[model samples]
Target chain A: MAEIIAASHGLVVTQAKDISQSSLALEADVVVIGSGAGGAVAAYELAKAGKSVIVLEAGPYVPSSEFTEDFSQAIVQLYEDKGTQTNADGDLMVLQGRCVGGSTVVNGCVAFRTPDYILDDWQKQYGLTNLTVDALEPYFARVEANLGIHVNPEHEINRNSAVLREGAKKLGISWKPFQRNIRECALTGHCLSGCATDRKQSMLVTYLPWATAHGARIYADTKVTQILAENGKATGVLAEVTDPKTGVKKADVSVKAKLVVLAAGAVQTPLLLQKSKLANSSGQVGKNFACHPSTFVVGQYEEDIHPWRGAMLGIYVDEWAHPSKGGYILEGGGAGAVELSAVTQPGLGEDFMDYMANLKKLAGIVTLIHDHNVGEISWDDDKKKIDYRVAEADYPAMKAAIASAVKLHFASGAKKVYLPTVVHAVVENPAEADAKVAAIELGLQSLRMVSYHPQGTCRMGSDAATSVCTPYGETHDVKNLFITDASLFPTSIIVNPQVTVYTLASYIADYIVQN
Target chain B: MTQNKNKAASDVSAALAPLSRRSVLKTGLWAVAGVSALAAGGFALLRPSPRDSLPVPAGLVHLEAQHYHLFSRLTEILLPTDGTALLPAAQVPVVNHIDGLLDALDPAIRQQLLTGLALFDNAAVVTHFKRFVDLPDADALAYVGDWVNSGVMPKRALGFVVTKLTHTGYWMDSQTWPMVEFDGPVSRRWGIPSRGNQPLPG
Candidate 1:
């Protein structure tokens, strides 16, 4: 808790120590909670539009200069719960960022526009008629241009991605390089940890800074305890400005605002709304949780793959990405030794040592399934209780996707393929992959799963009875209260959601400006 | 720390939140019979041992002597110091790192993890009549493997947590990088420039 407040370029940066009084109060035209993808964009747009904005972030501010490119350091500083948030059953690890820039600071930087099929599904099923591809195209284009979003060129496509492309071609699958929101990536392969050189266009280095430049005041390490509301209108927020490490309260801070925007990711956002006991007229505040439950298979090649030598993510196979075909995507994943150990063959003693010995020869391909909205988020005495079980209907698709990854590895000239299962299940030949995957259990913790994208917990739709927010991102029950995060997603977008969150937030910011 | 409790709770009882203490005790009894006991059962029957009162090493905040012994035994089996290994697990301060990690966790989670460690240690008492920490090297390895492949979700989860943390602690250290032929972190070495922002694509 040092340097409570700093002023530069029409911006004010404040920390908990800035307030000497037991309670500090402020007034702003707009107050945004959680400065990640949506919050940063909304803050920038509103502040640039001449609104006096105050942003409260519950996480600490560790700037690019502080980045170490070390997994332990990054997870401790950037990730929520130090990268250990999980479902109630503890089968799936749900990763969210907790810092000045939120998840954008720790995301893989894979950027994708909301797919047309996903948009169409929203229109047909959820009454999100205004959210058409053409309607949102301009916002997507602007965000892409603003962030320098572009496809990976030949140089950035390292051997790990090459394996994905070659395998997809051999198997007659459609593969393409990922569109990334980065400015000349250093190829250090630490996107999961954080971008050390300020190359990755995380909100920390992008919109948050842009907003601050436009006179948006930001308070880090401040946890909002309640949304002060009266007569169905949000008036302000009461927060505890605490030490980020010890959660020791330093002072009580309150912000009186004309408008309040919640962008605290899917889980935290819903949990906050539920905590306030506001904006739940539809009783859907913490319902309809959907996460793209992801698992991967590591392929061991005879040649040195050195997967960690390039971007953290690259090419992806979209042959079965469409809902009609199969709503799953296979991504070429790269990581350092610590992450590689998690997905590799699980064993004890020398057997595991021999596997780690061939680390340089290993590459991984990840599959993310478009799961159903069966998960729910609740709280038990302040502890986040996420009850998310992979739907039985989605199990076949999970197995199929993992099986496809196994085959792709063999087709890519891998000598051994390691499955992410309870026991050490390996497939030496492509022919045995199907039977092996078929036998893999779908029981809890039987398959190691992780989710970076947690969406649809607080859905947006035309029906007030079924949704927590409207199509324009306003809560159906509370006036001047808006949500602009992945929580507003009505369904899982079946891909990395940073770009889509940016687009919707950009669109919703315009709506707020107009209203 | 809320996140920490969830994770530790997840490991302690993958389905522990719903079970009553009585049910947990009953399940622990069942586990001793080699039956598939609920994961929470072990936590219910965990007794406070004299080891809990043992002294903790200096510079470590969370892990005590008993916890240290448990992790040290785990690393021996997972990443041994044998001739074929890259370096001895002892060379890396994995347990110390885990202790540092636990320092940041919620106290509830830390306590649950301790309970889990004690349960795992005492689990061997019924069959081998020896504490897991006192078991021979081969017995310890075999017992850990049984938990790894245990039909009980909690046991498997405990094994997963132990191995993941142990492997992460060891592999995260730079000393182990040479074994995997990894070029630690390249930003500083390569003088990677911090291109603040780039021009929009043409």
Candidate 2:
């Protein structure tokens, strides 16, 4: 699969046989540096618009047929950083995908448009004139139709989601069935392991395929190392193509394109720009890092929830999703035995074992705090350093969200409810939750906080002073270079960001075509 | 390809470090799942092979059979399976592919893991007791508790690290699935009924 392949679709997919033997290069109208939600969408959209596109993916492609149910195997194969990625402080563990489809391939398939208030804020605060909610609605509709986003039927809502839905009703909190981009989901309940059934409408099954059918060539096992620029314009990219089996760097591949679209996610996009010393004239290249820190609450119900039997997740509680009043949301999540064992709380060996013994009766809920603060990501001493500030306001928000989940579980007939963290202890009643939550110290060692949607590192704004890119996701300093991933978001949103990523990428594709 | 595994593990691990601490965390609380492994049902112990001179792994990811008896025995005590679930231990390991898993980890993590192992096996002679692997289960558990509570920085750190790795290793085993009543892939056990939530112990 090297040197190049002349596809039946009248496209040439040329790659390097040995990246190190000689320089390998190609040319395209548009060169995308990622194959995830943003890159795939932009590639497909641009290709469908009659623009030639080339996608360079950093991870090897593990076809759906080869995906396994053994999560341990899946973790190593599809996950980023050996499934051991920790926070900057090494407190919370972060899980992201590093395959051909990026995180979209391993995501839970939930889709949420960027909240209206967030779009409004971007317009008002960031001077994104054309990024109004009304302007994005059509793009959102297009993304929805393209991705097959729809509500799961009642039968698709598994026991785990049902438990959350029941608990939310008992507590009178607003909850709803989550819309997912899945086609005929078989309820494998292993979305974290990558969909083996090919039912998930991830980029692998959606935009990338569409892009491929439209002459966009995808080269996996190729990681872009530098954004090649000349005179403040992106000319192409320099990459290292690797031997997937031996993990050996086989060749140095280069792609020269008229326009370079960097959808390599929030982390790598800014990183690539930083490495090239381009697009940082404003010094906002890797700033404004906002994350929704998630806290976990597990309940042991009297009834067997069999949390693993349904769609990975189907319901979410949004009583606290409002930015003005609410700081978080509650939803159901499934953890396999290994995860349950590690996070069952009560650090005592015997007590943790007791919880594991009743695993079938346990159900876990998570609280995602819409935290406030623009954190920082930088390359320090050759290692990526994340300075994600867990704001003081975030503490009270986490407490409220967790306490609400515990109370809801009890109201829904849970015998025992616990918030799993460093100071591991069980919450017996609603009365004691706030106090217990408040007393626990907020530190990497005392509590765990993980994020799924990382945004605002390369924020798009009208001003070059505080933003890295324009409202259209084009870097203000680097012409012909665009960042279409979540990195362009001016701030955090209170929901899943996949839909927003897709919508924005489509908008960018249209912007490119129009310009 | 002898050096292939470690090189690939770190190469992919580089991606793990890609997202800023804050950027990826926004994937939403309930939108994702966590990583862990457990014992598969039916504890058919595929004991490490009895080869006298097993090929030493490039680094200390998982100890080779000849070098890992101490670590393996210690795992049994740290991660016992009794009273945990309905299914018996696997006819093979729950984490049947532990060897490859260990081989695929970053060497830095492996180094800390080996240091933890060394601290445990070495502590035995100083305390005038049998090796950690040779100690009875009850004695081993007690010693572990003491090591965690009474020791200095490195010793205390070792107890926590070893126990964590062992516990995680045990649960990650596909064999551990049945004990937890996890039916596994749809092809394997979708239509099967769950164990009664134990009749609610009225």
Candidate 3:
């Protein structure tokens, strides 16, 4: 089998032959810097269209067998900066997947179509007529089929998540099972730690392998430093071969191509463009960053409930996701033992242990809020770091979401409930919490929230004066260059961004092919 | 790789030949000394004591203690004492564990946690919990369980701590799993279930 695999691929190492020392010389039809959802989709489409392609990835090519269930090691290997905390006002912990599959390798397999309201808002406000829901539907459909997006109807609700349903039912708040991009998930709850079972249909298991099969070469541990340009047109890119061990400085490599696609994600894409001194004509390369701040609520049941034994996130509440309260969505989240241990705090651990000590009294739910546009992403000049600031204006939306979650838990008949507030740790009784709910209606202002979906750093618009890129994801100022990632989101869609990113990338790839 | 191999070989040879009691004692002393030196360096790096390092807001500690007492009492109340040999919630190891865990976190995280504890502070609310904890175990449990499920506390901290306690309790207490109809083993179970409806082993 090994010989057959090697013979079929003609040596995987040969496919990634080092072109660093050959100078910025050989020209290609297209160059994509990342092999994530966007980059992989773009590369596959372009390659299938008969365009020669080279993809530069900054992490090692980790096979499925290497994706262990060990959470700490998984974080170190797949996550950015080893899951480091960004001490923004709230000690905002940022987790971005950094390997060949990018975030798709580590993200919860929930696949949501870009919410229509977001597209409508973009079309109405940003004058982006090309981004209406109808226009993007076909692209979304194509990507969905390719990725095998589906709702897990028969996926058993583990004892852990069943408690969430029980609580919601008791509380009378509406909830529903979530749809994800997976096939035959084993309820292992190791999605965030990278699924070793090859069931979660992430980009790594889908489009990237497809791209590889179609002759697109992916060079891991090769970080692109700058997009090389000649007379205002992007010629290729200057990249360095990063060390496999330390990821520190190594040899330099330059690759020439007719077109370059920057899908290094929301943060790094802007940084790359900034380094190359491109896309600054509009001075909007890295601004208007938005994120969905999340908080968790837990309940203690008089039943054994091990929540970390199934799919990470299998349900969500979208009752408030319409235009009523400026749009909000709450989703369930799953964690392994390690992640669960890290999230649960000291005294709370004891309480949970005590409940579990009885083996019958613990359940939990996570509230993911689609907050208003009130954060900005700026690059620090001296450190070359991306600094994010959550504006005060969006604080109310977070508070409202928290309040709604608390109310839902009460209606769900949770015996003991806890809210994710910085000022209040636990409510000893439901009556007391209900009484204070009205007064603390906007509880989000006082509590810290986490964000996983970082978007809208480099937005798209019709005119070059106001936006960083055009509707086709081409930079308004730079020709022969395009962006296909969360960086181009005009607003924070009320859904996970991976599927949307793939759809947009496929659309842009087709547009590039046609033109 | 060759250098690593040579080092490994030498280390193995040294381990195989270490038979003298005097040499063993010397090696043990050296290991202890090295560990002590490392600990000292780590202590210096850690700097402040756990309590002092925490930046508890003005009224956070007292409120948290009050909440802690309330939680303990409520758990006791929730488990009915109708002549079952079940353990008392107050006697559960979770209370001490909670205190120890809070004391162990990074100072900054600890500080933020204290602030989270202070959000439920109306005079009446405080009085209600304070009085609730003094009630019989069943009543206290009923009250606190409802409060927790309603999401009144710091959502992340309370949920996290509760979940931890639940896991610890599961491992520590045999009664909970058996009573709740848990199908899986207590630990080290792996692999996907062949079908979602596979029955628990008798």
Q: Which ten residues in a row have the lowest lDDT in candidate 3 chain A?
A: A2-11
Candidate 2 overall lDDT versus native: 0.69
Q: Could you list the CA RMSD of all candidates, in the order they appear?
A: 4.9, 9.7, 13.6
Query: Candidate 2 on A189-296: residue-level lDDT in tens?
Result: 888777776667778766776777678898888889998888888899999888777787888888999999999887777888888899998999888887777766
Minimal lDDT window, size 10, model 1 chain A? A2-11
For each candidate, the DockQ is 0.30, 0.13, 0.04
TM-score of 2: 0.84
Could you list the iRMS of every candidate?
6.5, 12.6, 17.3
What ranges in model 2 sit over 4 Å off?
Answer: A1-21, B1-61, B64-70, B83-100, B120-160, B187-202
Pick by DockQ: 2 or 3, better one = 2
Cα lDDT tens digits, model 3, A354-461, are: 433433344556666565555555555523343454455655556566666666655555566666543345555666775554454343223344566878878999
State TM-scores per candidate: 0.91, 0.84, 0.71
Regions of model 1 farther than 4 Å from truth: A1-12, B1-57, B197-202
The native-contact fraction of candidate 2 is 0.19
Looking at candidate 1, what is the lDDT of residue A11?
24
True contacts kept of 3: 0.02
